[model samples]
Target: MKTQDQAAQGKVALVGAGPGDPELLTLKAVKAIFRADVLLVDDLVNPDILDHARFGARIIHVGKRGGCQSTPQEFIERLMIAEARAGHFVVRLKGGDPFIFGRGGEERAHLLDAGIEVDIINGISSGLAAPSSIGIPLTHRDWSQGAVFVTGHGKTADANPDWDALAKLGMTLVIYMGVARCREIQQALLAGGKPASTPVAVVHAATSGSQAQLITTLGDLPAALTESRLASPSIIVIGDVVRCASQDLFHRLTAEPDRIAG
Candidate 1:
């Protein structure tokens, strides 16, 4: 039981809203929402999650979607600091695992430097959820020995990943925000000796009603994405593990009852 004075003390909670499904939100995240005096939400978070916020909680949209008008990170930090300093419980709600490519580290550093107490609540990252939703396992004893998660978009072109090193690993590669530079990524992987026949799948709007997927070969990834016209907020999965979805075992399990009867 927290006293009113303790409740009013300035603090910040960096909460992960999970991938997209509102039901996937963690119980701890829901509790933080209810306790929040102000919520700084990301652009990718589903609106339904906000329903958990207590009545009269101030909600501020500070989403930063790629290639669109975005709230500056610096500004968002300053605002959070200001709000918390004013004795408000601030919740910085982000989509996916806040620590994974959500810039949660940066925000946490800023708040800590400003003498604000920070709490972190982890959530499911799309990297894991997207592939699982599509029946693609990141690791399988028969196929992939391990898995690697990397961001397709970096702070700068020079910061781009070393695709050659990744190709040598011979493991599942899950790329986040890679749609915009699919061609470049494809070329890099090809140059790094990855086979053209490597299986690739792009999951769009994962875990949402609008969720969709496109499966193709590594060599054809660019063309397939172009033909499908899939947009951002997509995860690109590559490796032999992708073939697991098409295996006879999976097909048999998912086969319709009518088909099985026939």
Candidate 2:
């Protein structure tokens, strides 16, 4: 296989920068960053992660906020093709795992169609990081033996989703990038037969030095967030395993009552 340094004309590395903290990056990801001639980073890709890049790396920031001046998806595809076509080692760096929510799939498909060699590197997802940051274990032998991940902003925004056997899955529920519509999700879950009192944890800026967790019941999701003042981009976890959080691995990463989110 040609290494990133080989500088092949039609090769791209889809690298996940992890949650936020620079320290969380894997060694392989760092190596990719160092070898890349151009970096296409997401809006949420932490600046600290970019410090690992080689000097003079061409950095291209692609906007991806809820209500920001964002680059069109097609335009980004073209950018990747153009950069990779130029024989530059291109690293497409996304905040979370590239395959999770990032449009890495679309980009990969496009690149593959063009016959560009693409390498995908997995990174810790905020979906996992957020729960761990707040001491919430997504699964427990007693509480839950499985887990499910869902996006809060996708379809079924207003309508009740007929969750297919999810209620009996005995799995912890996790919602990523879903703070604004969390209440609806909670309601849907409850309507689907999930207990109203299921424990819920809202973790903000998870896995970073600055992290905040809000403990609440599934029934009180909207109220809890409104009172706690946590906003979008935060991870939402729901299940009974959260009851053990304070003494778990995320104990040290938990933030104080007032957290600086930005």
Candidate 3:
């Protein structure tokens, strides 16, 4: 437990910057950023969002991007601890929702262990914003009963998500950081009994000005991705819900003729 004096002295806020769009930030998150004495930002966070920071607020970029050199996790934790100990309100601004694959849980645990006060502000996850940006609902009553948000990359090869089990769930699967391993993931899902014809949509930089997307089938995902050249920081949405994407986006891919009401 944090002592009253410790809590009053300093604190840290795990603020989600939302997807890529600066306007997507929640009101409370805006307030947190404006009041922050120091901000530790993630690589994926939109730079425009920083406009909300109060003038003269110290901003530190601690980017963590896959397949690229990133700030060490241990170092980031120590910095937050140090800043908070100095009686500064530290904001760990991250892209998307902090709790959803953002490593917020790990950070929270470390802060508590160090007796530092921590609070989390929710942001819209890219998984949700990405699909919605192009009019693809993750779940639909006539098609999907639920949605599953999963990471495409595992901490270790052996620790990867059970793609087979996930396929068997029959729920909408929204994969993050899976763009790099598209081929492997496609094979796993196919082997897990998912049909080759399953609709899939890969949205890159969802809700951002440079947003782009490709709609394809599970079997064609790898090839389509190669041909489309869409890269990481993308969301792969798999299921019939992908078929519900806006008509404009549907033109680029060969989709089944209107199966369900849009």
Question: Candidate 3, residues 1-262: lDDT per residue as tens digits?
Answer: 9677666678899999999999899999999999999999999999999999999999999988878999999999999999898899999999999999999999999999988889999999999999999899998999999999999998999989999999899999999999999999999999999999898898998888889888888888888888778888899999999878888667545544322111
Off-target runs (Cα >4 Å) in candidate 2 are: 1-8, 155-164, 247-262
Candidate 3 — which residues are off by over 4 angstroms?
1-8, 255-262
Q: Give each model a TM-score.
A: 0.91, 0.87, 0.94
Candidate 1 C-alpha lDDT tens digits along 121-194: 99999999998887899999998899999999899988989999998899999999999999999999999999
By lDDT, the candidates rank as 3, 1, 2
Query: Candidate 2: deviation at residue 110, Å?
Result: 0.6
TM-score (C-alpha, index-matched) for candidate 2: 0.87
Backbone clashes per model, in order? Answer: 1, 1, 0
For model 2, what is the alpha-carbon lDDT of residue 141?
80
For candidate 2, the per-residue lDDT at 46 reads 88
Arranged by TM-score with the best first, the candidates are 3, 1, 2
Error (Å) of candidate 3 at residue 246 is 0.8
